[model samples]
Target: LIADEYIKMSDGTYPVLFVANKGRNVLLGREAVMRKEKMQTNQIVKDDELFERLRALRRKLAQEQGVPPFVVFSDETLREMSGKVPLT
Candidate 1:
């Protein structure tokens, strides 16, 4: 793990357990925060409006690219995007 500091033993082995600060809004990126929430709860709540909008965008992109909507954005990705309600 890349860190600000680590120690080397006499045997020249470097090993340490590190955990990204949990639930600290300043510590994790938006996706990482939401993903951690999902992992803990086993479910993620999605915003319906964002979900529909993303679906429409994905459908359009898929048609233009001649691929399936899931190829443009999988269901899991859509769900996460919905949770974030990203405008872009």
Candidate 2:
């Protein structure tokens, strides 16, 4: 039921419909509009788990410093870190 231009378009933006049950499974672009054929749910779950862990750490640090958790590290940054899982 959600409608928004999820991707950038040079000509003009068009509304894209997100599937109710599939969780962002809809694909919208110049080519076509449809549901994504492949979904990496396992990797996403792992990344989400890591993101939660990072968030917990951020919360703890923020509490100690008397600042917001996002001040320690934004959610977008944490999400990227979780997906990459940098060794260093």
Candidate 3:
């Protein structure tokens, strides 16, 4: 899939892909340029304050439920949540 559409100075020099399930088209190369720009600037991607708050919440919930923090929510899930910051 990459080799077919790969292009330098246009679609980005590196590949950053995420294939969705249910045969959905994810616009494979669309974000490549944006990601490349971010990578070049050494961007701080994660929202540290929100992430820490989520971790603290996870810890509290875990303690209350008598299970590990990961059992409540994985770190990756928290990171995604912090990145998106969904209101609902």
lDDT of 1 by residue, 1-88 (tens): 1232222223337654544343333355543422234345554655787788889999999999999998989977888877876567
Q: After superposition, how far is residue 45 of candidate 3 from its true place, in Å?
A: 3.9
The TM-score measured for candidate 3 stands at 0.47
lDDT of each: 0.65, 0.67, 0.69
Q: Write the per-residue lDDT of candidate 2 for residues 7-86, one digit (tens) a residue.
A: 33233376544344333344333343566588655334347778889999999999999999989999878877888866
Of the pair 1 and 2, which is ahead by TM-score? Answer: 1
Enumerate clash totals for all models, in the order shown.
0, 0, 0
- TM-score against truth, every candidate: 0.48, 0.45, 0.47
RMSD of each: 12.1, 10.8, 13.2
TM-score of 1: 0.48
Sorted on TM-score, highest at the top, how do the candidates line up? Answer: 1, 3, 2
Candidate 3 residue pairs in clash (backbone atoms < 3 Å): none
Question: Comparing 1 and 3 by TM-score, which wins?
Answer: 1
